[model samples]
Target: MQSKKIAIIGAGVMGKKHAQTIVKHPDTELVAICDPFSDAMAQEFNVPNYKDLDDLLNTMTLDGVVIANPNRFHVSTAIQCMQHGVTCLLEKPLALNTAEALTLIEAQQSLNVPILVGHHRRHNKIIQQAKEIIDAGTLGEINTFNALWSVYKPDSYFDIEWHRVAGAGVLAINLVHDLDLMRYLNGEIESVQAMTSNKNRKLEVEDSISILVRFKNGALGTLLASDAAVSPWGWDQNTEENKTSFAVSPDQDCYFISGFEGALSVPNLEYWNYPKDQSKSWSTSLMKNKVEPNKEEDVYIRQLTHFVDVMNGIAEPISSPQDAIHNIQLLECIELAAKEQRTVYLEQLQCFKKSA
Candidate 1:
């Protein structure tokens, strides 16, 4: 089989990561790059670097494109790529807000182009295993989810002007990933109530947030995150998925999920339940079991491989645009809940109505 020719937009952190993964993957070829500002990566990779999206689209025949551009440009760039019938591996949030996300969702539905949103954590083998355990009723009738994402980013990390602004806070930049995973692992969120604060960082954007979510499946969840604190309790720290970007806290778990029959902790995959022979009551001691997850494969590589499958029409996108739009809507509901000092229902959001 021939390699799939791939081009990447936005030569930033994620763009570079995708380029490296693409080059290493057996099924992909790095054909070109599109970024108005930088060509350093393209030069290093020995690929043509076009400064314009149209130029890259018109000049090169690409089997797929990865949109890792700035948040503001995501929808427009994705529409352009779909216009050329190119599949996309769009980076997350899907868009800055639900309205923009809806436009991209509508475009994909109309053009029949596949878009696999880069909620790359979904590809992690641990997550795959966890999902299987839950789906198989091992954690029967899940009732609660508790997650934490706390870490202190270096002071210099916020030196960029945009980093202190409304659009680039812990909630949008960091917690969105956690919230997406919550929705992925738990179920659709029916409503959300939240509170946010920027007192610690004193920036225009929030540095800490606490959210209460009610899943459509009757499960309740709480997410607490802070980018202004020192801690080792986030998925990034616990999973070691990106060691270069985040320090690993070995053997730590970031999520605690419970149900009537059993309970599970994430990353570690520790299972606790009463013995089948014992009486199912508080008086009974719980047995601990371990679930081993495949640690050999890199999630980004798996995501790239899945993207190849999406491009080849062999597999439907694991994270489709319609599926991702809900995450964006959930984010909006969180922001609204914090701002209004009231619970925000997902079905009540205007964007959800528009999409529906």
Candidate 2:
């Protein structure tokens, strides 16, 4: 099959990742890089650079684009790509808020262009294996989850003024990821309650958040997100999933999922349950076994392959626009819950009014 032409829209950190990964895949050609601030990246990659998306769209015929722009611009850039009939892999947080996300949703539905949201964790082999275990009844009726992302960033990362501001806080940048993961692994969230504080940096936004969620399936979960803690208990820190990411401490358990029959710990992929044929009882000793997923696939490679498949009419998107919209809407409810100190239902999220 002929390779599809794709362009990288942002030259920042994530744009760098997209550009590097695109070259490794044989199914895609890294046609160009577009970013006014990233001339160095363009020169290093030996690709033509366009300071504007309009110029790139006009000058190059691209089958797709990967958008890693600021959260506020995600919707608009994606809408432009869709209007041009180009497929897109838009970075997460879906949009700055639910309203901005709706504009792209409307455009996508009306135009019938494929716009895949970049909730890359959904593409990870380990996460897929964990889901399959739960779905296979190995962990029967998953009832509770301990999901967390607690890591400390050095002071250098806060040098950017926007990094200390509200929309650029840990909630938008970090927590939005696991929010999608929870929705993906569990199911629809029925309600959420959250509390936050900025004791660490004392910035415009909270530095830490504790969220409680009730899944529509009757399972319950808690998500903790903090950028101030000096620890190594997150997906990125625990797995060799992506070597380009910083490796923190040696591996440790990042997730603990339990159901009626058994429990599973992530990264370790350890499975625990009472022996079969033995009566199920608290007194019965539980067995510990390592549950290994099939050898992992590079997520970027898989996602890029999937994107090419999406462009070629071979496979559907892992996270479509409709599915990813829920993540942003849920995030809205989480913010409201933290502010109001009350449980916020999914239905209430339907009309949440963001503060001006």
For candidate 2, list the clashing residue pairs, or say none: none
lDDT of each: 0.91, 0.84
Model 2: per-residue lDDT, tens digit, 1-356? Answer: 88899998888888989888899899889989888776888898899999988999988999999998777688889998888889999988677777777777878989999988888888888888888887889988889988888888888989988898886777777777787878787788889999999998888878899999999899999988888997778877776665566675435877788998999988678899999989999899999988675435888887888899899988889999788878888888888898899998877654333210
Q: Per-residue lDDT for 66-185 in model 1, tens only?
A: 999988898999999999999999998688778888888888889999999999989999999999888989889999999999999899989999898986887778887888888889
List where candidate 1 sits over 4 angstroms from the true fold: none
- Going through the candidates in the order shown, the clash numbers are 0, 0
**TM-scores for the candidates:** 0.97, 0.93
For model 2, the run of ten residues with the poorest summed lDDT: 347-356
Residue pairs with backbone atoms closer than 3 Å in model 1 (clashes): none
Tell me, by TM-score, which candidate is best: 1
What C-alpha RMSD separates each model from the true structure? Answer: 1.2, 2.7
